[model samples]
Structure formats: structure tokens, C-alpha cells
Target: MTHSPQLWQPLQYGTAEWQRVYFRLRNAIEGMNGFGKDPLYECLESGGTHRIRGIAAQAVLVAFQLAHANKRKLATWAGSIAVDGNRPHRRATRRRKTKPLGSWNHEGYLTEPSE
Candidate 1:
């Protein structure tokens, strides 16, 4: 692993609380998400909490925490959902229908873009 900035930095890794939370999340992800057999599980098993900031910070934190504890793949998926606001997959087109973006109305002004 390179020494560049990681996606998440450890706030405290060796603490008892961190270990407890990490193991709990790992078990939950493995048992609940069926990712126990994935290969990325070992890479994301480092026990630590991350400090995130922004509109979806909490959700991202939850995802990282899950990744740290359970399965990295599921955690990555969760992070993707949060980042994309749950956009539908492109390949699964038949199951989804496209809709026009909602019009925005602010300060008695209607902002409707031309189709």
C-alpha cells in the first residue's frame, strides 16, 4: 500500500471501543449481507473510525464503518448509493423508467428548463 492519503484515516485503532465496534460491524456485514466469502474482506478489516464532513458525511461514515467491520464490496456499494443519491444502474434498464427532472420554484420564480 502506498503512503498517500487514504479514503479514511484512523481516529483510534487500538482502543477497546474501536475493536468492539469493528468486530460487531464485521460480523453484521458478513452475516447479514452475505459478503463473508468475498476477498476484499481482509483488506477492509482494519479497526478504526473515520471523520467525514458534508451533506452525506454520516451516511458515508456508516458505509466505511460497515466496510471496516463486514464486507468491503457492500460497503463500497453503500458509499456509491450515498454519493449518487441512489441512482439506478445503467445495465438494468428494462426494470427502470426515466422521468424528467422536477421543476424548481424559488422566490416566486419558476425555473423550468426547456425539454
Candidate 2:
């Protein structure tokens, strides 16, 4: 049996499969761009000039920003898993004791009963 090229041809633009793939690719690209602009990356806002002078410099800056973004993404992922109670490997930490502000005595004024 001969396989026709049309069998593997790309989906039509307005088709459901095409739209689903297009939206997934578009969202992935936009999400990465947003991550690069996030405070942790900051490369988009770093330099005094909006444009880099050399292609090498621009490439280096972008590479650095992508590395930092990846690092931050991994850190956040790890932290989430570490704190997730559903994860059996999650580590337990001591909770800090906190007191309400109303229980404190400021100067001569008592915020709450001293007892």
C-alpha cells in the first residue's frame, strides 16, 4: 500500500486540531516572554539603552536571562513540592509562634490585658 503525502498534510487553519495546536504554541511562547520580563529575570529592563550594541552582547544577555528564568522556575517547582502535604517526600518544618498585636503593651498604653 502506498502512503499519500496528503495523508500527513498539515491541518486546515480554522480546524479544531489546528486551533488547538496554534493556541498551545502561542501560549507557550507568551508565557516564556512573560517569564523573561518577570522581576527575577529583569533582563528586559536591565540596560540603559533599549537595544544592545552588538549581536554577541544581545545573545549573551538573552542566554543569561533564559538561564535565570529556568533556575527560578525550577526553584519554585521544587519549593511547591517541598511544601505540598500530598507529597510523601515533603519535609516538615517547625511553625513559628505568633502573637496578635492586641496582646502587646506599647509604652504606657496597654493594647490588651496584661494577665
Candidate 3:
């Protein structure tokens, strides 16, 4: 039998640490793509005929979307600041519901609900 020396590399693709780093980076890129498509934020339209043509125009559009996303994020963070400036407001996972002013009764009269 013949023996051969193996070369050592710093970053092994199959390693746990490398996988974690790779996944994190991949997730970040995916998140950015989703953010760009968000209606409330960048609202980037990918379908149909594009208003701006050419590589330069597309690059400029992407740049503007990124800038808008950054601005909106900053504004949200700024608004979250507490009155005493001690801590930021916690993000609400669910939306708050508002009560309707009036409802129709048996007589078809619009009146407030009886408690």
C-alpha cells in the first residue's frame, strides 16, 4: 500500500461553521430581495414592461429602492424611541383593532352598542 499526504484548507465547505456562515449570508440576501418587493417599502415592480430600460437605468432604480428602504427603516427606528429616550418601542406582531362608531339595530337605526 502507498501513502499520500493530504493538503489542509482553512474553510471546509462541509463543516458546521462554514454551513452556518453560508446559510446566514444566503438568508440575508433573500431578505433583502423580499424587502425590495415589499409594497409599503421599496415596492419594486418586477413584472410587465419596465419604464426604465438598459443596465444603467436598472442599476439606478435598484439604488433608489435601497435608499428608500434605508430611509423607511431609519424613520421606524426613530419613531420607536421612548419618551424618556431610555428604550425603543417593541414592534407589534399583530395589528390593533379599532371599534366601529355605530351598528344597525333591529329598527335599522344606527346606534352605539349597548354594554
Top-lDDT candidate index: 3
Predicted candidate 1 versus true structure: per-residue lDDT over 32-102, tens digit per residue: 55453334553233333334566597567657655565555555566555344666333333656644345
Clashes of 1: 2
> Against the unseen true structure, what C-alpha lDDT does each candidate score?
0.56, 0.73, 0.75
- Flag clash pairs in model 1: 26-69, 26-70
Candidate 2's TM-score reads: 0.53
Sorted by TM-score (best first), the order is: 3, 2, 1
Using TM-score as the measure, the top candidate is: 3
How well is each residue in 1-115 modelled by candidate 3, as lDDT tens digits? 6434465556677899989988999998888778778876567766432478899988887888788887877778787887785777777689688555467667877776679
**Deviation in Å, model 1, residue 67 alpha carbon:** 17
- Segments of candidate 3 deviating more than 4 angstroms: 1-10, 48-50, 77-85, 89-115
Ranking by lDDT: 3, 2, 1
Compared with the true structure, model 1 gives a TM-score of: 0.23
